[model samples]
Target chain A: MDVDICGPSIPTILGIASEQVHASSTGWSPIYVQDNFGVMSVGFMLPSSRDAIMWRGPKKNGLISQFLKDVDWGDLDYLLIDTPPGTSDEHLSIVQYLKESGIDGAVVITTPQEVALQDVRREIDFCRKVGIRVLGIVENMSGFVCPNCKNESQIFKPSTGGAKRLAEETGLEFLGAVPLDPRIGKSADFGVSFLDEYPDSPATTAYLDIIDRIKQLVD
Target chain B: MDVDICGPSIPTILGIASEQVHASSTGWSPIYVQDNFGVMSVGFMLPSSRDAIMWRGPKKNGLISQFLKDVDWGDLDYLLIDTPPGTSDEHLSIVQYLKESGIDGAVVITTPQEVALQDVRREIDFCRKVGIRVLGIVENMSGFVCPNCKNESQIFKPSTGGAKRLAEETGLEFLGAVPLDPRIGKSADFGVSFLDEYPDSPATTAYLDIIDRIKQLVD
Candidate 1:
């Protein structure tokens, strides 16, 4: 479920932005891409993609609460809540709403830069204070292999050792690092799985490895 | 004013994270970077850099309102409000609160990618609906010049002609593009001015040009 209410890009990234949520006797049905894989986002309810959701914290919290209560998410192994950066209203709302239900842990994603790592550190602290476990840290845009020269460039130079060092310091597992691949963003924009399209890419390999680790930790 | 309550970073970026806001008879004093320039952020109020501010929208809005009223901003030529991404509470609160005071416009900063551009487009739509003028768009991380080969690479590849095309498509001014210079982030993290640190760099040149354009537009 895409809980990033302000900018719900899950629909866009999942190639389901055009789909809408259908309400029935059961409840609001999640638009399924596959028989088992289903998704829900405020993006589906938008009159238009360009329309801004000019909602305040309380109203946003209401929608999120309603989303959990109303969405007919059937037979789910795990309900991952994708949030935007920062530990604000949406993050608080989800945690509070799910306190009884319980959140397994949070997987922190950060760019290979001190600036972003700083935020991730704060997020980890937030997880601790809120009693949520941090599964691990995943470094993204760790390095970019120049398509022309094949020389890897630390595009977002991790001034402070990036997520690996961060995880080590925090005593958490370092999931993996995904190299900078422009095609990954393109695939996301087109709503296609990068893993499926670029099966042999380093980024895909890294993502798969990270996915495996997360599965082992959670499952 | 740094209105990103959950993650106020203006202090860290300005290299003044160690300083605290001194409240006296005149109200809160903004930490000065120079003789003329001063900044205020919630970072200064933090007990520590690693602490997370888990505030909801209403509480954040209240603090923002208090900041505006309590801060001893004396005489100001222009009060710039730096906001986080998304068209949510903080965005709406600022617009609503400033509607009576009259806001000049918004300076939208974005990266050279469709994903970021999509958000910029939504933000512009938000500006229109909120009756705020979009001064222009400034694209950051447009390209990276490899240090070894000195060959330019569109690191965050402009899959759709970057922000220049988006500006043209939306009938907004394209201020400039700041090439990816990792030093820029380093400088910000350390609270030093990248322009001053690397006076001869192309990123500095782009920033100076963009600053000039923004000054002309805003003034």
Candidate 2:
């Protein structure tokens, strides 16, 4: 489930942007990629791809509440919610609304850059203060492997020791580091799975490893 | 004024994260980088860089209002307001508050990716709907130059023609495309001006060109 009301890219990233939410007798049905994999995002409700949902906090919160209440995904092993980057209405609203239903934990993702690490600190603090269990932190765009030479490059140079060091300092689990593979963006653009296409890629290996860690750490 | 309440990166980006906000008899003083370049951000108010501004819409709106009203900018050529990416409370509040004083125009920044372009569409639409004049669009991270091989790579591939085509389709000005230079990020992380450090770099050239276009188009 994607609660990123302002900029919901989960559907687009998952390559299910064209899929729309439909209501059945039970409740609002989330778009299903497979029998087991279900997805929900604001993208599915947009009238057009270009159409912007120009809403403020109150209206956004209402929709989020409705999403929590109405979205029917029966007997799910886990309900992973994707969020926008910030400590704003969505974050607060989600925490408040999910206090009863419960949030297993938040998997904070950040780039291996000082600027990004700054935000991660605040995000982790937010989780701690609000009683939300932080599962771990995932360092994305850790390095770029040049397609031509395969020589690794620190695209966004970690000026301050990056997420691994940050995890050690903060006592948060450093889930894994995913290398910047151009195919990931291309796959996202094409609405295809990068893991499926590039099973042998370093990024794929990192992602799988991270998933394993997250599962072990939490559910 | 940095109205990005949640992630106030302006202070960090400007290399004044250590500075604290000081109130004068007249109003609040914005931290000056140089004689002419004055800046303000929530980063200044925080006790530490790691401290999170855990605020919702109302509180965030209150602080934003204070920033607009109390900040003693003292007559400038331009008071460029940096914002977080989205059409949320901050966006709405800024538009409403600035309706009387008036906003010169908004120069939307985006990347060369389909997913980013989708968000840009929403942001542009938000600006249009709220009667904010969009000066133009500038594409960042358009391409990356391999420092090792000097070979160019599209880190985030423009799967759907990127900002240039998006600008063309929307009939908005395409200011320029700034290539992803590691030096640029390094400068930002270190709180130094990329333009100053890499005066001769291609990214600097692109940024200067875009700045010129923005100044001519708006002010």
Candidate 3:
């Protein structure tokens, strides 16, 4: 479930912002997408796409609890919760709510730059302190491949060894790196999966490889 | 004062993270910088540059309130508080604490893209709802200039008329646009001012023009 309450971009990313969420007897029902992936976000409840969620701590925590307890999410293989950037309130709320549910582990995604890695380090520490087993680290936007020339460039220069180095430092597993593809952004804007659109892209290959690693770890 | 509690980038941006915050009888004193600017951020309290603040809402609100009330900020002409993205707890807390200070409105900074403009729209609405007057809007990363070729490219693509258009739609003043210069990022990374480094750059000129506009609005 997409729980980034403040700026829930999942519906927009999936091109289902127009889809209305229903109120079931149990709680709120999520919008079902392809592959039986049920999605619930504040975006679904917002009056308009441009509306901002000006909520305080209590309100946010309450909504998060509701999303967890109220949402009628049935049996699923995996339920990925996308959070906003930071190791803040949302993370705490999610961990607290899902404590008994056996939240498999967290897959921390980060860019290669030190500025981003600094936060990721803190995220790792947070998980450790909170007793959430970190599954692995995934370095996104690792490198950029030019469309015409196919030449690789470090737009967001991985100057500090990226996620692999971070994994090594923290003794966590390093999943893989997803190169920067222009089509990825376009795909997100168009409400389509870049993996499906550009099957042959390096990012897709990296994703598949990472998924394999995750399966091995989980299994 | 940079109010972004989770990830305070001001100290890093200004290259003053190493400076220790002083505890005074009145309150905590801010670091004095050039141009008589008194800077205070959560970054100063951090143990290391790479450290992350994994705080929830209550802690964040407490720190923000402390920054506002406890900081021994003497009389100042202007006190710019750089907040993190979104109009959530931080914004609300700041507004609540500084309600009697006669806040001189806000200068909404955004990039030249619908994706960014969408958030800016929400921000404008937030200001209106809270009764915080918006000074104007500044469109950043409007265009990119190739260092080698000197050819300007709309990397961010101001396709939707960006901030100016949004200002027009919302009946707010369109301050100006700051072009995407590689030096700007480098300056930020190096903890220096881009305006000081690239005095003649288009961005610097634009900043000057925007400042003039702001002066007209305020003075």
Tell me, by lDDT, which candidate is best: 2
The list of candidate 3 runs beyond 4 A from truth reads: A145-153, B146-161
Ranking by TM-score: 2, 1, 3
For model 3, give the TM-score of chain B.
Answer: 0.96
Please list, in the order the candidates appear, how each scores on TM-score for chain B only: 0.98, 0.98, 0.96
As for lDDT, the candidate ahead, 1 or 2, is 2
List ranges where model 1 is wrong by over 4 Å. none
The lDDT of model 3 is: 0.81
DockQ, model 3, C-alpha based: 0.45
Look at candidate 1 and give me any clashing residue pairs.
Answer: B15-B191
lDDT of 2 by residue, A19-92 (tens): 98998888889998888999988889989877778787889889888888888888989888888888878888
Pick by TM-score: 2 or 3, better one: 2
lDDT by candidate, in order shown: 0.88, 0.89, 0.81
Shares of reference contacts reproduced by the candidates, in order, are 0.59, 0.71, 0.39
Candidates sorted by DockQ, best first: 2, 1, 3
Question: Alpha-carbon error at B76 in model 1, in Å?
Answer: 0.9
**Model 2, span B70-113: residue lDDT tens:** 88989888878888888888899999998998998999999898
- Using Cα atoms, each model's DockQ against the true complex is 0.69, 0.79, 0.45
Candidate 3 lDDT over residue span A54-89, tens digit each: 997778889989888888888777778898877788
